[model samples]
Target: MELNSAKPGLLCSLEASQSQRTMYPYVTGTSVVALKYKDGILMAADMGGSYGSTLRYKSVERMKPIGKHCLIGASGEISDFQEVLRYLDELTLNDKMCDDGNSLGPKEIHSYLTRVMYNRRNKFDPLWNSLVLGGVKNGQTYLGMVTMIGVNFEDNHIATGFGNHLARPILRDEWREDLSFEDGVKLLEKCMRVLLYRDRSAVNKLQIANITEEGVTISQPYSLRTFWGFSAFINPTPGAQ
Candidate 1:
């Protein structure tokens, strides 16, 4: 008897075919929180990346300064976010080469990212990230978000991943049109703290990027003050990360 040799060959062929078809995320980040403030825009994200359920890497930066008038924060596959950054670096480099005395602002960067993401989606090999973009252009605060499938929209405030679920409600209630830089930082920290408690992938350390007419200022990585002592934990507490 041949012992059904053809079945094994078929299974191996299917596995190989699937593996060659696309780039899948391995290590990924969790959420990004951002909003427009009185001066410009503030964006925040943690320095952690997860390998599946394991918190695999710390000190992974999820935010970057883009051009002169823009900052970008990402949640989802870490490598995919790096790839997107390379694309933007090229875009900005090309703009600088033109010497037209004009630079790509946040809105332009967001639109370009929309096209890149949509094009990748059509290829069925999307970048696997939800990105938050913010900046100040000629005193206008622009904040927008783009997803892996090319869906994009602008709002006064935005959050991705767990943040969309946990942090946006706080932003809606307390975010103000005249939010000073100090107040904005406090608000973002408050949001991140909530996520750290609820989100399994969230890390204690994070960064906040501030973009304004003057330029961009990304703060050094810092950890938030957290409280883990509560009577609720004795009975299997809520969000005990």
Candidate 2:
């Protein structure tokens, strides 16, 4: 028997096949916390990215520095957040080139990001993230949150994703506009501890960053337990309450 080959134009690929190959899954990040202190802003996020009941990551650093004085902490797709960081880095470098070698400041960075997020939202394909932008704007500490769809608002304290449910209440209760920098730090530390206990996505060892007029300072693997005077494993006496 002779075999015959099908003509190229006579056959078409299945639509379902194309769709299946092109479709990508969406991933959500767990929590991000941001608060404004007297001198600057403090932000932290959980290391975990959960899909359903599964833990995806445990050491992800969701916070990023946009320029010299501004910091951005995000909760959502890690890949998308990384792209935003890359774009911001390029934008900052370009701005510096036009400013006689002076790096872009917090306000300038925030304005640039507002336009970036809005532009993406107009295209109907946003970055799939919520962001906290903070630093000193106009000689005073400033803090704002931007949603995935580009809505931006300033707040004394803001928490997104899982942190919104687990950490925001604690933050709001303790937040004071007249709080000193030290008090602000202590409050944030307490907030992180609460999240670690209540928010499954949050971990005890986490990254913390402070943005101020002086610039951005990031602490690596800051120990929440050390600050709280407790170890990860608690030893209980037989009759302990």
Candidate 3:
């Protein structure tokens, strides 16, 4: 009894769990938008991180390339997203070390992440992020989402967080399987512009990532051009007074 009490295995475990669990996200992002195009998958997200109602950081890059086949965008806690990336880093490193010439693909990465998120939820300590993963493999374009609690699904177009509320409707109205690269970009911009207008947490500065048969290309950070000349913008309730 003394030795077992000295180890304090259960106590140590409880402490570790408490340390890692996030009851709520502190620094968070707003939305992620992605879709399929003629050549590949395109993903976009802004660079802002909000703490409660305050915009705390303005240069957080929430999209990253996974292995050689996936582009991942995340919305929600920035630190949790970074930890998830570290998990992928270890996973990819191990895959390469195998030296079997078989690398992990987009589907595999997505599945692994789904399991990770689910497991974390089962532990009652979720990652507090919504993830959008997109890729092109063997001429097949893939786009999917996994929420913070691990609900996952595939779709022709995907938007997370505020994008799900404000941007997906636009995607549903206009997305197509045969969209050209230029058209796809224009479509994403349209969605993002709406999020910027409606989602107070969203910022104009953002990055776009493209993953294709050739490889992944993440654009340098840039801002979208917006117009505020609409009547509603000039005065929201013109006659309320």
Candidate 4:
């Protein structure tokens, strides 16, 4: 039998596939929480990204804006979320060129993401993330979530990854149709506290954001402290026994 020579097209195809595979990483983030309030929306996520069983990072920001008006809180595949945010930025900028000359609103951005997730699902290569979209829609504040496979749903509150398991219940208990912005912020802090206690992947260092018709406001990181504990030993063990 005679051997067939390698074709340039086949080599090019293989190289292209290998390059894509190499570019994608397996790091994943966890625990994103979001809720809608009377004024707007509040969202938060912990700062941990885990690679398998190892905790890989402690300062990842999982909350960001899509365009100027929409906020997204994401869990899973930090790099993928960054790419999606970039895509959203470009998409919104492109939409500004329409005859209407308007950037993508929150609902429009959510629809775009749904399509992107579905298209990736059809390709059997997914973004491997869950995202919360929060902002104003039709003069009203809106909160919604998109799953890895493109399922999108609206809710008074939403949680993803570890937060779904540990923080959602606490949110559900306090969530109300009439919750004010201050109440929403307090609720989100409480939710983070619950996750910090229950979810091993979560910590006291939290990133919280609020989006409204006015704009987005993110809180600075603050320590969750204990008033009484072993820390009393800093100066001297108080009756060490």
Number of the predicted model whose lDDT against the real structure is largest: 1
Question: What C-alpha lDDT do the candidate models reach, one value each?
Answer: 0.92, 0.74, 0.90, 0.79
Q: Considering lDDT, which of the candidate structures 1 and 3 is the better prediction for this target?
A: 1
Q: Please give, for residues 1-241, the per-residue lDDT of candidate 4 as tens digits.
A: 2224667777777678776421454777878888887778888887877776587787888888776688988888888888788888788767776649566778777888899998887787888789889887557877788898999988889999877877888887778978987788788888777677656677567778989887888887665642333444355666764
Q: 115-155 in candidate 1: lDDT tens per residue?
A: 99999999898999999999899889899999999999999
Ranking by lDDT: 1, 3, 4, 2
Q: Where in model 4 is the C-alpha error above 4 Å?
A: 1-25, 99-101, 226-241
lDDT of 3 by residue, 8-72 (tens): 88778767777856788999999999999888998989999999999989999999998888889
lDDT (Cα, tens digit) per residue for candidate 2, span 1-241: 1123644443333334444221232555667788887777888766666664567667778887776678888887777788789898788778777978576666666677777888887876677778888887558777887877778878889988767777788887888877777787788777777777666666666777888777888887766654434444465467543
Write down the lDDT that model 4 would get: 0.79
Report lDDT (Cα) of residue 11, candidate 3.
72
Find the number of clashing residue pairs for candidate 4.
Answer: 0
lDDT over C-alpha atoms for residue 68 of model 4: 61
lDDT over C-alpha atoms for residue 197 of model 1: 90
Candidate with more favorable, higher TM-score: 2 or 4 = 4
| TM-score of candidate 1 to 2 decimals | 0.90
